[model samples]
Target chain A: MLAIEDLHVWYGSSHVIQGLSLTVPAGGAVALLGRNGAGKTTTLRAIMGLVARRGGRVRLDGRGLESLPPHRIARAGIAYVPESRGIFPSLSVLENLTVAARGTGWSLERVFETFPSLTERRDHGGGALSGGEQQMLAIARALMTNARLLILDEPTEGLAPLVVGEIETLLAGLKETGLGILLVEQNLAFATALADTVHVLGKGRIRWRGDGTELAGVPEITRDWLGV
Target chain B: MLLDPTFLAIQFLNGLQLASLLFLLAVGLSVVFGLMGFINLAHGTLYMIGAYIGLSVARSTGSFWLALVAAPVAVALLGMVFHVVLLRHMQAASPMKQVLVTFGLIFVGLDSVRYIWGNYSHGIDLPAVLAGGVSVLGETYPIYRLFIIGLGLAVLAALHWGLERTRLGALVRAGVDDRETAAALGIDVGLAFFAVFCLGCALAGLAGVVAAPVLSVYPGMDMSVLILTLIVVVIGGPGSLKGAALGALVIGMAQTFGQVLVPALASVMIYAVMAAVLLARPGGLVRARHG
Candidate 1:
């Protein structure tokens, strides 16, 4: 379980995330939907401690994670997959996976099994992999950390339709395995399908929050807040 | 004269010897700059300290072998202290600030060595076992120079194996590739970088001890080798191991052969090579992938 309350972040004079609060229950999915520069990415960054949070209380399973470093936060069971996929270009596919492996639950064999495309290119450099494969490798790497919570930023962005379907299927399976996922996505269909609850963000504030099914009838939220 | 087999063979060996020293000096500088983006102008100071420490150890123990081992360990420990106390703080500072601080450290290191040992050249006695000459191409050559070449190759091989086949090497590669991602994956990058920094310092010490017998230990010795080492890193591409190896060899052979072949232009030939390399590939022979 993850809980973030009244998170405030600033980039010099510009306020990025202003008093945002959210929660993801164990084995549940929460999707943050917003347009460009709506602070969705900033919220994820604040949770990961990549950016300094001026004010916030982040708790993972009742323990405070506000002051921890990024590495410490990761080890505490949060695995972050950035928008770029964060693959080490010089490292081989296998090295990229093993570099962050926590030696529990997800073994190299399991990852290879889960991602057969990756298995074939185990010796290939991470940079050499295609966009679809890179995204798969990123998720697979996150799993290798044995993390209970997976934080993904725009995993479906710039992906092919067929590859998007594959990723959606893979994530659906992961959701069934009781892994809590907090996803920031622009694809409304993908987000609504995978997430149990959806929150539309507008100008660093949550404009609407409700069940994924309820979001379909509320066209105004999607039109005004998410710019759909 | 250039066609003479014996003369060419001797020059070839001389070039190798110079390359060996350059490799030992440049590898650490390359990796540190590449991984942490820390411009350590004071790295050569470690080499000078290693030589001074080696001289002291050899004099105290009357054993060149003992000095070789003791000097690197001492310098590495000293480097660890410096990193924790000073260098680590500079990691977040501007590059200009990092340069100024490290450059200041070069003077501090130089003045410290002067205050302790005074401004005079000293030499380490060649171990009796390696004191004699060996026959090569119908001419005798110093075995110690060959030993230097062998040592360099051995270190290179070891480094190659360590970096390619080990988990620590994987973490380092990952850190070098993307520090933020590596950290977010739960790697203690700061600790790993600390280990690397100490190793770099140790290698510099090894180079200083190894070169002392041939180059002799002297005041401002760090400055001369620092220039050559920096040139090697620049030409090799900072952060690339392969680049450092290739760059060191290139510079080493160029400096060695330049001295004999173009006596008038020898002093500026290495600089010319560097400029030509920059013109061809501004990123150097091998580029660090991320930046």
Candidate 2:
């Protein structure tokens, strides 16, 4: 369970996230969708304490996370998969997963079992993985931390269609496992498929909020806000 | 004399011994640079301090063995204090600032040693256990020098195991690869950096203590060793363990053999090797992850 109240973030003189707020209930999925430069990524970054928040509060359950650092936020059970995936090119696939591993809920063998494609590449360097494998590795690494919240920024970006399908299926399965997910995505269909609630972001503020299924009936909002 | 097998053998062993010392100094410099992008020009001063500390312990306890253990531990503790008090703040500072700050500490370190230890050069007596020469390749070599070589290899092996097989090593490699991401993964990256800086300091101290019997221990002794350690890191590639090893070997061999083979141009040989390596591979022998 996570909640954000009136979040404001700035990058120097330029204001990036302007008084934004959203929530992802326990075991629920919330998707933040918008066009490029719409502050979708910044919102996630601010939540993870990766960027300085000019104003507002972020709460996990009931505890405030505004004063915490990135590592502290992560330790508090928020696993962030950045836009870059952030895999260490020098480390092996197994090392990348184990480096951040925390609890008994997720083990090395468990991760390998879940992603059979990665089992064979355990000893290979992270840089050597294919785009799909890297994306899987990123998700697997998050799981290793036994995090209660999974915050993913554009996990499907630059991925092939088949890989995207695999990722979507994998995420859907993870949702069934009761992991709270806050996702930022440009892919409308993919977001709608997994998200229980959808929020369209425009200019760093929430412009629309509705059921995930209701978004398909509204074209004007998509055209004006999402450019989709 | 130059073509004699015994002379060449002795020279080879001498080069190895020098390389071992250089490796001890260079590896720490390489890792610290790689982890934080911070240039510690005062590393050689740490080495000199180690020798001074070792001298004090040896003289007071009359045990070279005790000095060997005490010196590195003291230097490591001192390094931790230095990092917390000053270097930690300069982590995000510019390269010029890092260079100037650390370079300033060199003089401070030298003068401080002089103030306490006097300007006269000192040496430690070799322990009886490692005092005599051992026959090798139809010649004899000081057991202490051989011990340095063995200790270097042992440290190298230990380092390799720690870095490759341990969890802390994985965290370090991950931090070196991407600092922000490592933090996001719940790793205390700052702590890792602190540990690495301390480790580097301890190794330099160890090298100084180990070399006390073989080299003069004096206030300004850090200068020549500092320059050579820098070259080793550069030619070996910054932040790479393998690079440090190769660089140390090349420079150490060049310096040792060059003295006998080309006494007139001995001072220029190591520099020439660095230039040649840079010309071929601008990133050094092994391109480190951060480099």
Candidate 3:
């Protein structure tokens, strides 16, 4: 379980993630949906300790996480899949998977089974992989870390419909294993499919929070904040 | 000079000797830059310290082996201390600031070496086993020079294997590719950097110790080699061991071959080759697969 309260982040003179709060319960997938520059990514980064948090109370399973470094926070159990799918380009796909693996919640065998394309391209360079394949590699790498909480930033961005479907299935399957997931997505359909609870972010604050069915019925939040 | 077989052969051997030494230093420089993105202009200073320490140890112990063992270790410890005390603080600073700090250390290192060694050009005598020349291709050559070549090849093989196959190598490559991502993956990036910087410095020092018998151990020696090795690392791709070795060989061959074949242009021929390589590839001969 992960809980974030009154998170504040700033970059030089510009203020991003101003007094935001959210939570992802055990085995719960929380989808953060918003238009561009809505502070969704910043909120995830703040939780990961990648950015300077001016004010925040990020708690993971009752442990305070605001003061720790990114690596320490990760070791405490949170895997991040950034938008760029940060694979070590110089390394082979196998090395990429093995290098990030910590406690081994999912073995390389399971990862290979899940993403057969990764196994086919095991010896190939990480950078040489296609966008969809890279995204698969990124997700596989996150799962490899054995972190209970996964912070995914636009995991389905630029992916084809088929690939998106695969990702949807993958997340749906992963959620069954008691893994907490925080996803920032623009694709409403994909997000709605997996997320039990959804929050619409406007500017730097949570504009709306409800179950998938409730959100689907609220046309005002979808139209005004998400521009959907 | 025009078409002499024996002359070319001798130059070829000399080039190999030079390359052997160049590989040791260039690999360190390339790796340090590749791993941490830290341009340590003072790397050559560590090499000078090695020579100075090796000479002193050899003088007191009367054993080349002891000097060889002690000198590089001392330099490594010194490098670790420097990293902990200073370079660590400058990690996120601008390139100019980092350069200024490292460049300043070059002078400080030079002064320290000078104060200890008394500003004279010193040289090491080859161990008794390698004191004489052996016949190679019917030409007499120093056995110590051959030893240098052999030592360099052995290092190249070990480094190549250790980096490409081992767990440590995976961690290092991971750290180099993306520090934040690597850290997020539970890698101690700071520790990796520290280990790499120390190893790089020690290797540079080892080159100084091993090559001291041939090279004049003087104040400005570090500057000349630093410039050449920097060029070599650039030519080979900044972070690759293969690149460093290839660069060293190319530069060594260019310098030695040019001296014999085109005596007039020998001094500038290496630069010409570097220019040609850069113009063609721009990324160096061995491009790192990552950005």
Task: Please tell me which predicted candidate would have the highest TM-score against the true structure.
Answer: 1
Where does candidate 1 stray beyond 4 Å? none
Encode model 3's per-residue lDDT on B216-289: one tens digit a residue: 68887799798788889999998888999999999989888888788999889989999999999898999874
Query: What is the per-residue lDDT of model 2 for residues B169-285, given as tens digits with 9 covering 90 to 100?
Result: 998889888888898889998898788789889999999999999997988889989999999999999988888989999998999999999999999999999999999999899
Better of 1 and 3 by TM-score: 1
TM-scores of the candidates are 0.96, 0.96, 0.93
- Evaluated at residue B153, the lDDT of candidate 1 is 93
Model 1 Cα lDDT, one tens digit per residue, A33-118: 99999999989989988985458799999999999999999999999999999999878999999888995889999999999999
Write out the backbone clash pairs for model 3: none
Please list the Cα RMSD from the true structure of every candidate, rounded to 1 decimal place: 1.6, 1.8, 2.3
- Each candidate's DockQ: 0.87, 0.86, 0.67
Tell me the TM-score of model 2. 0.96
TM-score of 3: 0.93
Better of 1 and 3 by DockQ: 1
Taken over the whole model, the C-alpha lDDT of each candidate is: 0.92, 0.92, 0.88
CAPRI grade of model 2: high
- Two-way lDDT contest, 2 vs 3, winner: 2
Worst 10 residues of 1 chain A by lDDT: A47-56
